[model samples]
Target chain A: MNDYHNRRGFLKKSAITTLASLVGTKIMFAENIPARVTPLPLLSDSVDGKDPEMTVLSDRPMNMEAPAHLLDDPVTPINKMFIRNNGLPPVKESIDRSAWTLTIDGESVKQKRTYTISELKQRFKPHTYQLVLECGGNGRSGYYPPASGNQWSQGAVHCAAWTGIRLKDILADVGLKDNAVYIGYYGKDIHLSRDAKKVVISRGVPIKKALEDETLIAWAVNGDDIPLFHGAPLRLVIGGWPASVSGKWLHTISVRNIVHDGPKMGGSSYRVPVIPVQPGEKVEETEENFRIIESMPVKSLITHPKSGAVLSSNRSLSVRGHAWAGDLEVTEVNVSIDYGCTWQKANLSAPKNRLAWQQWSAKIDFPQNGYYEIWVKATDSKGVSQPMVMPQWNPKGYLNNACHRIAVKVVV
Target chain B: MNVRRVTLAVAAFFVIAMGITCVSDLRNDQTTTDTTATTSLVDTLNYDPHSGLVVDTTLGLVVANCSGCHSTELIRKSRFTRDGWIAKIRWMQKEQNLWDLGKNEKSILDYLEKYYSPSSLDARAQMRREPLDDIQWYDYQ
Candidate 1:
């Protein structure tokens, strides 16, 4: 009698489970039904050895950004550095490092000059400095109405020690003319389409920024040869400016009397609004309305006790993160535990160089077990602090330096 | 006798389910044909994983013409109006060394406008709903 009852109970539960599964499947199918469900390839699935945590915006042009929690170190590792490519990387097999040459010429150049990788090492004094290279669209996803570009989050910036010869030293050897107003760089990466133009990305800076001691024509990163994806044979390393100014696979340096009109220089590509505009407001793209985005704004990120983390209420938690400002020092970092109700100063560390990011940390005790939010705001030496909310929106979504907020739960 | 009746009933149910699935599939195919068949070159093609673009009617032209220089992601990520798409093609031709598309330009524009129009209401709403609040904040310790 007991066996009969048990069998009946098992059959009843199985029937209910089957019915539930069928209903669930129907709902899922209905929701996914589209006019034409065309299958598009998933880029992240095709790539190998990529950090599974990193977000892959696109695979072909190979634009990927590291996860914020993974970017906790003061010095980002080579693999962790975000990859932002405008075009396909050159064929690795065809790269002849020994034969590689960089030419220096333009209207403002007194005479044309060329230097091989080995010659550059032998002739010029090598210098090393830890600097931060950040994408101009680091926080593009925060923009309202969305911008037209790779929607990057906070991990589009990385700090690393680069070893290279000073760019000014090379320019001095080439003899810059008095009229040299702008400097432009060109690379070997070609357009993917055969009929398309030869140049991929060619950008430059003013003569003054070009001559800065921190500017380098880098051959190595973090004491090792730069990886092929990061620009193998050689690349430029202009500190404190948008990374676009520092061309990769660099081959040519042109000293021009006027601003260089490269592939990415025009058409509101890297330019931002000249003045603050309302968020999500549509504006016309004109030279008078927008200007080239140069130095980045002051920014900070909270790395520790990650958002949505669970912690013990009885214990004091230490918070830590990195802070940086382009062409300026991070003078202070303040942490607020009670949703900005009270702020405590975090201890800031000195940067290794002028353009490197400073590390900041603070320890706080949770009053009671519940939900808590920690906010971090960084101030530059110029007294500019990161805004509490996202700053004015621009066409390209550049320079979003809002204070970092982390929400955590404390339990008994 | 009872077993035979149960088997027949199951078979009938499967047949009806398959008929419904086939009808829905045909409906989807017809919708695509109606929209994309304005050009003569619309052919059923397999998905190509390398370019991340569908291998349908106008896709072959796009892959043949565009993917040779850059990844298809550049095209896929952008959403523009019909005029905006035309303007981009013109800009590419004038400045970026893109060759003339000739007669294929019309078909290409049609395909892009149909498949990749400016963010639809549903897609825009979905993107807007993606929570920025959950983004992991990083700091130094």
Candidate 2:
């Protein structure tokens, strides 16, 4: 009799759970949440890790849904254009123009020096590049096992015409000391807690790379003084590298003989698995030493007809999106209309300079409808193409370059 | 006399708040979970009365097991099975640095085992309503 009762009770609960699962847990949460309160502010985009000063792709980076954000015109307006930032946004809106300072120290032959934002602009003619700044953990939220860092959704990235003085000019002034192994930098962010430790908050570039003319200490985005969330006053624009290494809200830069180390540096924070593992499966460091995090890998996404978009019959759909590769230049972009089975080359819009995402387009003949999947693959000039799957997964989400796929629905 | 009393109360409140805010970030109690080869760095230590960082029990078992070397993002976004979870967990623990389980570990694993218990079901049930559906979707798939 007791067993019969237990079984009956179990059946009732099972029936209820099945119903809930059908409706979607994510949907249910949305229904219950009040209209006024914001829901998850998920990090919005995936970034190429190479250029630290670069930005997130997708026409609209306001939120994290992929399939590439589309723009009717070639140029994404400055306001509607995507925005991405690493770490926390600066707390101050108008940091005291007088109080802010830039310090250059470390392995330089000359002693350390500090300068204000005004002095930086005054001393050097500001150079401009329509560059993109992306986070190392741009799509980090997509990491398996859900690392405990910022529960960033996708929008933690953006692109703009960053304008500033040449980084080489500044380094040349002090004269690069011969033993310098890395160039390290820090920002104005002081955690609310004095004793709280930070994970790999600092990043470095090989001294040899610092000599390039493309690098700069940028103060403007587009034509405007960078807004606070975009790192106001001054930020580093490391051409062809990951945004992590390109410091944001930069204040201090040091040339050092040793590899930078801290919670954020030389730790398990940015490791890739020794071997490829199943999705969500952990990857361990094998016999070999861990590899250092560096430049962005090749990746691309379809922007127009945002995934699941309803299309007009044979409307001459102009498929457009953006593609990026770290350090290396994007040689070609391939778009697949029949999903991953086939591919076609896309015409890259103007060369917006290699440091920024070059817009690409393919005109596809929209035919009779069923659910259609669009796939885009990018190949760097170096021949590295975005893979359909990442090699493996790691704890602190690092580089992810799986080809982005979008599903489209058709209606008569 | 009433004004004086009010002033004292306000001043005391400020002092207490300032004190708490100053010391709140210093609590790095290191508790390492070997399964994910994860040391309880900042998040575990930076406990806030209001932080929404608690691990979902069933999910936590899966994550704690997987995060040995990698992170929990893989689990959260997976569109997996009882065998999938188990197979992946074994790979993580054996091949990766995922922790070897303890007696308490089974509780979480059981929960995940029972939940992710195989079936091509995506658990996107609408338990709660959209907060801003009225304002319109925020954009993205």
Candidate 3:
């Protein structure tokens, strides 16, 4: 035993001691630490009320994404909602929902205002909207030389009906100064290192985005207490933007005179290159070269008749999916079965509300009995369309709103 | 039952073997009992199976430093060159308050680059090269 310990060069006892001290409340003794750590659970295993089919990328600072096939529902249920966390969630048992308080303050705020959860619900009129939240790095796996973060496919996006008070109403109550340029949020999630001073992730949007009618300080998702995993007591629900901007477990909102310089606001955290770079080129992360991603790009997903569907030669396939453009409306969606060689427009539905994803469907008749790929493309109100291939590769691989294609085998 | 007889026979054989070994070790004055207890504790305490870290020379360092805050899946899924790994470490130090690894940095980086470096041969890279051709195709209703 002594020899084994001696052979190991970097088993500094301080690492364990620090962790023990940090989680001292939960784990009292060193022996309490499990002797043998178990192997990674099978992906089929589910926890925290999430569906078993959802992919588990990492569990420590839990990050999970739903598979594309499972995302067919228009209003993504709490179980199906993708979870992307920068740090561990606050302990659910310890949270006092009624006593939860949200403070609005910053350099540009005329007056600092604090409201208990109950007070905010009672004083302000409630509104609900089906908001689409997508990770900035959604579809990151398609980037060549793959990105450094979670290898999310297309599952890191969802549309859920959020019920909460308008953020504009709260800002009006607090009174913003003329100099207000941005709004930054702070959440109660504990940092990974358990450093009290180190925030897990604090990001915010511009003041204009904050004042939009759909921007909300939401506490309910699909008309229930926000699940603990999704941010329980309170959270910000800014639609049509990177979900990171909709900070979860929200506790404080700061009206800033300058652009929000919170933890993830700087660097290449959620920013893309200002100019397109070669696929393999390395670019230094700088304010001059990289700019924060604002409204997301035009994107769509074919949710029904999931990829790799097998069908009889005579059967016509009915394809349906959802499309959304950040801060813009999806004007049209087209489907092609001949590998983009020929195209036909699909019937597109109006969004339930602004910033909500629009649904579309089309019946595709196969010309022969072989293999085929169904491709869907969406065009936004600004005349911007989804790229056939991935957008120019940035260093961080932020946005890849390429047309989503699925496969089908037509058997004779 | 015959099963009970077989179980008793196996148990008796192990008991006899252990008795002989213990008696021989006692005569040899080798502290065999102490060694057995130590071995059991080491087996239970030393390794974490769930971390998903490839066992290597720097496994101790990687576990001590990296797994404390996040799962090793983050490392397993990521592919980076040596400089990229260094940049990640620096980011953690600057933003995450990761303590200076000092001399152990080289070993950790070496282990990571050896095992986790970007390669076109990885499963994910292959996935990019070809859409999943092996997935079980289901009948469309």
Best-fitting candidate, measured by TM-score? 3
Per candidate, native contacts kept equal: 0.17, 0.00, 0.39
> All models, DockQ values?
0.10, 0.03, 0.17
Q: Which parts of model 2 have CA positions greater than 4 angstroms off? A: A1-67, A70-87, A140-157, A192-200, A273-288, B1-141
Which regions in candidate 3 have their CA more than 4 angstroms from the true location? A1-47, B1-49, B121-134
Interface RMSD of each: 18.5, 19.2, 14.6
**Models sorted by lDDT, best on top:** 3, 1, 2
Return the interface RMSD of model 1: 18.5
Give the TM-score of chain A, superposed on the true chain A, for all candidates in the order listed. Answer: 0.87, 0.76, 0.89
Query: What do the candidate models score in CA lDDT, each in turn?
Result: 0.71, 0.52, 0.76
Q: Candidate 3 lDDT, tens digit per residue, A1-412?
A: 1111111212224434544454343323333222211111222233456764576667777888887878888899888899999998898887899889999999999989999999999999999999999999998877876677888888899999999999999999989899999999999999998998888888999999999999999999999999877888899999998999999899999999999999999988899888888776888878998899999999999999878799964558889989999999999999998867889999999999999999899998887888888889999999999877767787877888988888899995
Kindly list the per-residue Cα lDDT of model 2 for residues B1-141, writing each as its tens digit.
Answer: 000122234444543454345334344432211111011111232221111122333444444454443333333233244555565667546533456677745675555453233221211122111111111222222
Instruction: Return the TM-score for each candidate structure.
Output: 0.75, 0.63, 0.82
Count clashes in each candidate, considering only residues at least 3 apart in sequence or on different chains.
15, 79, 0
lDDT of 2 by residue, A288-326 (tens): 545666676776666666555565444346677777787
